[model samples]
Target chain A: MEKKYVIGIDLGGTKISGALATVEGDIISQYTVPTKASEGELPVLGRIIETIEKVLEEGKAVVEEVKSIGIGSPGPLDTKTGVIITTPNLPFKNFKLVQPIVEKFGIPTYLDNDANAAAIGEYVFGAGKGTENMVFITVSTGIGGGAIINGKAFRGSTSNALEVGHMTLEQDGPICGCGNHGCAEALASGTAIGKRAKEAVTQGLKTSLANYENPGSYEVFQEAAKGDDVAKEILDKALTYLGICVGNVITSFDPEMVIIGGGVSQGGAVVFDKVKEVVKERCFETLAENCKIVPAGLGTDAGVKGAVALAILESK
Target chain B: MEKKYVIGIDLGGTKISGALATVEGDIISQYTVPTKASEGELPVLGRIIETIEKVLEEGKAVVEEVKSIGIGSPGPLDTKTGVIITTPNLPFKNFKLVQPIVEKFGIPTYLDNDANAAAIGEYVFGAGKGTENMVFITVSTGIGGGAIINGKAFRGSTSNALEVGHMTLEQDGPICGCGNHGCAEALASGTAIGKRAKEAVTQGLKTSLANYENPGSYEVFQEAAKGDDVAKEILDKALTYLGICVGNVITSFDPEMVIIGGGVSQGGAVVFDKVKEVVKERCFETLAENCKIVPAGLGTDAGVKGAVALAILESK
Candidate 1:
């Protein structure tokens, strides 16, 4: 029997990434193209298509060898219909994402929320590997994640599951990008970290962070490591809120593992250790001991590899 | 195929409720016996067995026709091994619950957390019927819950998933029964409502609630509806926190339906309507519309029915 392959695409506002992988998920080749999203949907789609074509050519693979193509996008998308409902950064509304890809390559195509794809990546090959239930959370610019339930991405009735970061933490807390008050994303994400740091500076809290015009989450982490009290307080508060979200996920989904990814988690043990400490303290004792909180194993490859996992798993 | 039957037992702190139900979840007969749990493990176990036998006898059923027995108990129990792992109210520690039933009947036995069984009962035959994923939460004297994913109970690796009430809503909030601060149970449960009301009366707040020696959650709800400011404030706060938890569950699990049961919810449309209003205001825009927050349909039978659900669903 001949080996089968699939194409996985990670569509983002900044870049379009594509990979050709075997059925077992070994990447054979990869390619990427800048997504000038400001140029709008047509150009972004062109870049996505070009990126896939380049990956297929470089891999020396034909459409017949590929079972299907999968795309993971930042979205509140309709995965069953492969339609992009409305994304925060992308210039699209009710855009037919799967039909175009299927028509272009003559292979079946599937689409899912990028976080869900990343979760599949972790579940199949990363930290969540071998766990029947796992939650993959990325504490990046904004907290975002997806859950793998019973060894599959748990899409709800509308294909939207694991919208974790928007859960309310403080009823009267700060407003979130989603126009809600006290969402986990609004109170604990990297964006929230930066916002809090800026607020401290604006409040004239004598902190070393004020040296920069505007500090990102990385700078805040660095300053906190340097023992800057205000920065330390801000980082601690953010991680504490994040820890509450993790605890909520623990009680809510009760996954076997929770894999932390995204840029903010790249702060490594500093953030993971603190968040785990809080979760262990706050979560129910019966469930907390059985759950392992770990960092994502796939790093930058999660999106592409997760897309591949989605293709391989959902194709059937 | 011959008609099959099963036995479901709800082992609560004060009573053991048993039901004889058909394979399709139709209850044929029910029996209840006082637990007198302080009588130690052997007596309680005897009570559980007697209750099941009584249920079968009253239904005019024979043990030969019974496929299996399922029990739902207040836990920290090992559902996998069918061991009671030292519940808060029960004197038993490391007690074998499933083996005794199996030994007595020469039939298979399944044991699960009471909340988990109730969730299955709701998903299979109650308000959550016809939905692939549902969350059942009971906000009574204490808050507790279970989740059903893909039409089955989502027991975690240790058979302890969906500890919804224990998730922290406030880091520095009141201490919960689980020894954590600001758990949803600590902040929003019926106990919490009563505590807040009593505290208000102690603080000498002028309100109609002070007429009662100790106002409970039911009284608070009653006075709130009657336009008592203090009672209204206390109930509204508890319900608001409950709404936040509901919203969190929506974003975390993205279930098709959220079924609220327990005495507090039995306040009928008054509490459910307020809680739904808060959930709609707090949940993610994409998911809020898709999830229906409704009252549990099984009512008092949820526990026994859920136990029945566990017996039938897990036996296969």
Candidate 2:
């Protein structure tokens, strides 16, 4: 019999979501459960496994029918060795996340960083579909990215290419989590925007944001849209940094498209317009003209769908 | 007879050099002729063909014995269409360079930007020989680069990737020849270094560099070596910017090696040391550790040899 199904697990800090899908990516069954990360490594691992089993049972599918399993998790992990080398949200520490699953299900498995999975997802089914080369940048609390090179996910020597968040934009700007100063993440990430806004609120800046006890990028975007001078100023500064980051990426990669995703991209035109304007001003006219910068197409179910896309891609 | 030979042409403003070589890249015969670009497009085209004929005759090889012809020239050209799209030094304007050669010789032909050809040369036979992923940066009058991704030259959508010279480092840096401000080329190219020294001399800065009639990077390096503080400071700033440019490349590509080539790199220890130090300071530790940053191994013949490598690699 032909293999007709695949399983995808999206391991997040709070929830473990699993999907049983056809080779075409239609989800037949899904299950979700708490990660209970505080319960430590094995328990969290057990929960991931339990969700997979639940999706299989609910879909009335056999492990033999599933072509492969793909798991998407936060990383700094080794994809080739399948070790979660200690991500912040997940409890796994140098844990062999794929071996036990392969043993239990007797199926081929693939593991990748969430950003890479998301890039593959976009390449296979989202806004980046049909692009020979593209970059997916997710700008939420942090800025992260992945590249689709020659129509495939490109993992560099250390399985860690497209670390755009760490690209230094300002030589003497804010410190980044990676111990570098002036990184794109340090200057333009959602966290950076929120921090700047909170500081302004605390400093008694004349803005409507002072209404919130504690404000972040969400409130700052809201206030900016409502005509707050301080809020507008903060978004302009942060978004310019974001634009420079995108411009630099375009200069370096010269990809067909740049797909912006994550919480910040949800701000829509305000975000896209500024990035396009800056890219036009900074990049070579040829590069700027040839490339399209747009928002990610994957919605709330992006994580799980990304994992499914990863399975289908890697399996092929 | 078995096809066991290739031809390489290094196209330049004043000279055209062609080589007939073994499939393995040993030069069997070579020829050089003045470009006489002032004679216009067809005359320059005829000169290139003449060089090819000269090399073939000198090598005592027939067309049937040659596998392919490769030409390396100044770019913004279309490798896909074999068109030389108006280069500064070359008289060709949207000229179809490869088709004529292929028609005359009845052999496959390839054309690539000089930088991309040089990168393939390094990947095949120079410092980047063993790297699966590497970036080649040549910091001469301008800074240009090429990337080898997964052991292949990766030209993005428009076949014009790795335009690193234009990457913005300073938001308000000195204007570049491209009319952009704060490009890596504007801040760190050998031309930029020379321009800075000229400005210093014109300003009557207290430095030995002022002793030269028209001071440039060579004089600056010389004076800096003699302990001229002004020259040393200029070098420090320029090399720092170069380092930041390289650091950002490492951060974005995560390649196994970064090969620095071209005229400025001949400064040796001063260039390498500062770039290495900055990369360590600015890039993620893991990326820095995994990537080897080194000067290019190819010497005077890199251009022609690169054309040879381009023929062999692309034909394969």
Candidate 3:
């Protein structure tokens, strides 16, 4: 029989989502379960195994029908070595993910950073298709990024390339989680957006955002859209930082396009339009003229589909 | 005769150098002429043509064997259009370099940024030979950079990808000529080094550098080597900035190696040792361990050799 199926696992902070998909990239079935962080590695592994089993059962496929498994997890993980070195969100440190998954499933396994996997998903099936070079940026609680060059993930010399979020935009702007000052993440991340809103409220600034019991970034954006002066100021500051970061990426990489994703990007045109304007104004004319900035197309399914792509590619 | 040769021209603000080289990269003959750029573009173009003719004459029989010509000059140039759009050092504005060379020599000509040509030269025949990914940084009057990825010059989405020197290391440390704040060039270029030395002298910091009638970076390095506290302090500051820039590049690109050139890099082990120390300190352990830093081996001949490489590759 022809080889037709692959397994894709997206290991998030709280759950593991696994899917079995056909070679054509159509998902056959999927399973999801709690990651149980406090239960440690063995329990997490058990959950992953259960998810894989459930997906296979739902697909009604024998073990021989599956090709390989791919896992997309938060990093500093070693893609070459298949080790999850130390991810703050995950319970295990230096977890040997590949060997365990391969042994348990009796098939090959591959691992990659979630952001990189998402970038590959974009490159192969989403917004970056047909482009030789692209940058994918996800602006959530913390910002993350990935690069695609020449149709493959550009994994820098050490699998740590495309850290666009860590690049400094304002040298003296704010303290970052990475212990740096004025990093792009420190200025424009979801955390930063909320922090700005909170500071404005505490500083006696008048705004509709103050009505939220605890104003998060989304609420601030909501308030700003509704014509709250303080919320508008905070949103503007976030956009300015976001724009500079976008300009910096455009200048440094010169990618054909940049795909913006993550929760904060859900602000939609409010963030996207302003970022496009700032990047156009600040980046070199040549770069600004050529680069197209677009929202990520895959949305919530990007991670799982990226993992599936990895499985198919790695297995072959 | 076996496929003839190519003319490689390197245009600088003060001089124009051209070489007649075999397809195998063996130089048959070379010549240089004063640009006298103060007199402006027409005269400079005249000097460039004269140098090309002089080299062809010296090569004699090899002239008949020449295939194409390539010119490497300072940018911002339109590589696709073969036009020098604007170069701070050159008098020309929007000079069409290719039309003139092709018109006069009756050979297809290629034009690229000097830094990019140097990078291609290094990639093909110099320090970066056999490597698919590398970054070449030249620290002269100002810092300039180029990138080679997958055995070709990585010219971003447009023809202007690697402007490493302009990347910010200190968000607000110093103002750069490019109208940016805290660019790597502003912190560690030869001009920056010279500025620090002059400032120290004006501030009445005691140092052996004070004895020099006209202090340059070379004298400053000499004084620092001799254990002048102020000189050492300034040199360390420069090294710190250079190291951060290097670390950032390493983190961002993941190239197998980074080659340093230009006059300031010629300060030898003093700058090299400091740069290595800082890169190790700032970069992730895996990246720091995997990447190598080395001095550029091509010396002043890099540009001409790189232009030859460009011609050979483009002709093919």
Candidate 4:
């Protein structure tokens, strides 16, 4: 039978989402399940397999009809060996994630880090479509990125390229989770913004932030929009650092476009405006003028689509 | 006739060097001439043409035996259009440097920025000969770089990727020649080191540097080696920033190797040690450990070889 179907699994810490889609990316059926990652490796793996089965059943698709399976997971994992090396949220520790899947399904399987998968998704089906070079950045609890160079994923020597978040933006700024000082993630990520807000409230600074039990970037954006000076100041500082990170990316990569996504990017005009201004200030005029920085085109359902994109592109 | 030869031209502000080489990168004949750029565009173009002819005659090779001709020059230039948009050292402004040469020789010609040409040279014939992914950085009066991705020159959308020098290392640090503050070039380049020593001497700081008519990085390196406090302090600070820049490159690109070239890199152990230290401190342990950081392999004749590499690689 002609292979017209593919399976895409977004393996996250809290949940696993799977989709059965046409080769052209039209989703026929999808399923989601709680990961219960604390249950250890085998149980979580079973849940992921279950997710695949449910999607296939709902879509009325057989294993022979599927071209391939693609898994997008949190990583420090080995993409070449198809192993989930070790990740904080997941239970896998150098687990051979792809081997079992491919054996069970009797189909080719591919696995990549979530950031890289998302970048491929953007390059193939979202905002970065048609561009040979683009960067996809996610500014959530932490900053992470992936790059498409010459129309293919640039995985560097060890499949760890485009670790833009860990880049040192300031020589002596705040200490980062990576044990480095002045990393972009330490200064600009959603977690960083929340930590700063928490520090301000704890210091007895006068602000509306104290009113919230816990103010993350979402609450800060809300308060800033309502004219809270403390909130506005915090947003301004964090976004400025974010802008510097984006600017540095432009200076380093000179890609055709940079697509920003994730929690912090949801702040709308404030985030993009600051990033654009700083990029122009930091990069060459021609590069700044020619490259476009915009929000991600994919929406809330981007996770499965990104996995699907990984499957589609890698299969080709 | 067998295509056994190629011509390479290194077009610099003060002088232009040309080479005729076998397809295997063995230089058969070479010649050099003053650029005389102030005389106007055509004169310089004529000199380039004349140099190519001389190399061919000296090598006892004809146009039929040459596969292609390559030119490496100072830029902001269009590699796609064969146009030099403008450069500080060269007198070309939107001048088509490749067209007339191709017309005269009846052979394919390629033009690229010097940094990129050097990168290609390293990838093909120097320290990075076997590296599939490597970054070539030249830290001189200013810092500039180029990258080899998957064994090809990975110039981005505008043919201007790998501008690692301009990445912000300090948010409110010294202003750069590009009018930005805290660029890697502003903080750690040979020019920056020289500027710092000059300022200290001018301010009448107690140091042996004041004994000299003019002080530069070479002088600072000498004094620091002899245990001059001011010079040592300057070297320490500048090298730290240079380390940070290299660390940032490691974080961003995660290439197999980063080969540092140009004037400042010649400071020997002091420069390499400081850069390695900072890179380890600021980068991921796996990346810092895995990525090789070393001095460039090609020496004084690197310019002509770089141009030749550009021709050889592009022709394929």
The most accurate candidate by DockQ is: 4
Prediction-by-prediction clash tally: 0, 0, 6, 0
Model 3 lDDT tens row, A244-299: 77777777788999999899889999999999987765566778889999988896
User: Could you tell me how far off, in angstroms, the CA of residue B92 lies in candidate 2 after the best superposition?
Assistant: 2.2
Give the runs in model 2 whose Cα sits over 4 Å from its true position.
Answer: none
CAPRI band for model 3: acceptable
In the order shown, the candidates' DockQ scores are 0.72, 0.79, 0.44, 0.83
**What TM-score does chain B get in every candidate?**
0.96, 0.98, 0.93, 0.98
Across residues B1-316, which tens digit of lDDT does each residue of candidate 3 receive? 5567888999888778899888878998999888788897787878878888888899884444678888899998888889898888877899987888778877888899998899888887888887888999889888888888767677776678777777756545678887777778889998998888888888888887788777878887888888989889888988878877787777678789999989998998988888888777655677778888998979768878888888886787
Clashing pairs in 4: none
Best of the two (2, 4) by DockQ: 4
Off by over 4 Å in 1: A1-3, A38-43, B1-3
So what's the TM-score on candidate 1?
A: 0.96
Candidate 2 chain A worst ten-residue window by lDDT? A86-95
Query: What tier of docking accuracy does candidate 2 attain?
Result: medium
lDDT, candidate 1, equals: 0.86
lDDT of each: 0.86, 0.91, 0.83, 0.91
- Please write out the lDDT profile of model 1 over residues B161-275, one tens digit for every residue: 7788887887788999888898899888999999998999999999998999989998998898899999998888888899888888888778888999898998888788888
